[model samples]
Target: MKFERLPFIMKNLIRYQATMKENDWNKGFDLLRSIEFQEGVYKTGPMFFSMEPAENEPRYRNFEFFMPVNFQVEGE
Candidate 1:
């Protein structure tokens, strides 16, 4: 799902948590994902781009990112 540009504090927290063990990192990530999910899935925010656009349209373009609901089994 699309996420708003995380605030500096939140970003720092996430980065710090990511440095932990694998299971711990997963737990933190899962918690963040759940919070985002509960807040309504879709969001629109600024993202950085390095390429020069042919026309001026805010350096970033609006993007629609979504999270898959569930995993599918083979031959479901």
Candidate 2:
């Protein structure tokens, strides 16, 4: 395996969050892609995703998906 360290830079992000059933990860990416295409936003870097146990639902997970963009996104 190969590993490389990346530096942190402050940038705009288009994010989506939801509590979803286990293994439903791809949907967030699809949603973000749709938003990107519709908004004509330039993607500045790689997408980022994180998951944790849902706060109130044990069988589901809280997922956060972030896409770094060149311009600020207007909505939440």
Q: Indicate which candidate wins on lDDT.
A: 2
RMSD over all Cα atoms, model 1:
17.3
Clashes of 2: 0
Q: Could you tell me the lDDT of residue 42 within candidate 2? A: 74
The reply for model 2, stretches above 4 Å from the true place, is 1-7
Cα deviation of 54 in candidate 1 (Å)? 49
Worst 10 residues of 1 by lDDT: 9-18
lDDT of 1 by residue, 1-76 (tens): 9888865421211111222322232454455456445644432332221222223454433222222323211210
| Separate clash counts for every candidate | 0, 0
Best by TM-score: 2
Q: Tens digits of per-residue lDDT for model 2 on 4-32?
A: 89997758988899889878889999899
